[model samples]
Target: MAEEKAAENTAAQAAPQVQMRVLGQFIRDMSFENVMAQKGVSGDVQPEIAVQVNLDAKKRSAEHQYEVAIKLNLKSKAKGLEDILFLCEIDYCGLFHVEGVAEDQLHPFLLIECPRMLFPFLRRIVSDITRDGGYPPVNLDNIDFVALYRNELMRRQAEAQKTEA
Candidate 1:
């Protein structure tokens, strides 16, 4: 029993530990435009709103620290009118510390896990900004980080193939 306990302790000590922590979060930039606010447009006209989201990550230091940024661009325009109703752009970033993750898994971890951690705050900011800008709150849908990452990978692969061709 003592030998078995010692073996288990040794195995536990030899196992690598993984840890992820958010150090800080901030808005890198924000822009809002109410293009038709002064035009006195009727409330009956509903505009089509388009939202785009992009993610980026960079290593902050030689250590396992990284900065992940989520960029959101939103534009709303009346269905048949060329005039835009409102536009919003926001860049939200988070500082993350990841330790003991394998080198091969690090890229996905940063792109997927870090953004997943920061998305709720980004969503809230978008909602608040749109509401405060005189329109209904823009509640962003939940993001699928894994799907995004996979799509990005496929895009890059296609680009590489195109270059080779």
Candidate 2:
């Protein structure tokens, strides 16, 4: 019985491991508006920044291939006066060839892991855009993908419940 158990364990251990490769990454769309440059601001300005993030994943026509995209909307304004400072919007996407991930877990894996992989490139773009737009570079903080996924699930559930009621 012990020998049989050992053989079973060995077989399970030999199962294929997950494999993921980034085929490519690119900016699907981007826009930056320097409101401060357009409408000059007078006095001391304290900038307040707001950022919104949205993620999407879709299967490509090719087998084991997926496309993951992230949309970022950023706005900056003077704190007290609420005068617009700048607005930046970007849609970035990555093409991934994935294998060995279980189908049940593929959704979260694509949404979370894929974005985590692409974030650094996206951050660099944001920093450059802000600095070139005449403001100091805005470095974004690290995102918590797990929390983001959970919040999205909860939001969808709440919306569904509201509609059903």
Candidate 3:
């Protein structure tokens, strides 16, 4: 009886229930304007673009979980003509099971690579959208995920400092 109880207890304890945590993550939001690219140079007309980025974060129900969301807004024009062809927002997150990890490791995992994993898929979708728009493919620039994360940290710190002061 004792051995059976011990075995049961061991099995329960050995079960993988360490809990999930976001060690770190990275996110990227970009836009490509192939129509503008084509008509601007080809038609000898200047193509103007307005690009903006918004970042946000949230916590999941799990004890050690987090999500960093990036939103991108882009608009293109040709010689003051309307070309509002692309409007998109990418909201995706990774399920990270993190335990026994240091903060240094966790931060980068959530801030840098997580977004990198989701970016390719998002990019492919955006490229296809542009291609289908009867223009060349809109390839996104390689993102500086590390820099973006650092900037977010700095901005948050600055806001906190202001609040405290």
Query: Which candidate tops lDDT?
Result: 2
Pull out the clashing pairs in model 2: none
Per-residue lDDT tens digits of candidate 2, residues 9-28? 99888876899999999999
TM-score of each: 0.88, 0.92, 0.56
Score residue 117 of candidate 1 by CA lDDT. 97
Q: In model 3, which regions exceed 4 Å deviation?
A: 1-46, 54-59, 62-68, 79-86
CA lDDT scores, all candidates in order: 0.92, 0.94, 0.60
Greater TM-score among 1 and 2 belongs to 2
- Candidate 3 Cα deviation (angstroms), residue 24: 16
- Lowest summed lDDT across 10 adjacent residues in model 2 is found at 37-46
Measured over all alpha carbons after superposition, the RMSD of each candidate to the real structure, in angstroms, is 2.5, 2.2, 9.1
lDDT of 1 at 75: 93
User: Using TM-score as the measure, what is the rank order of every candidate, best first?
Assistant: 2, 1, 3
How many pairs of residues collide in each model? Answer: 0, 0, 13
Query: Worst 10-residue stretch by lDDT in candidate 1?
Result: 38-47
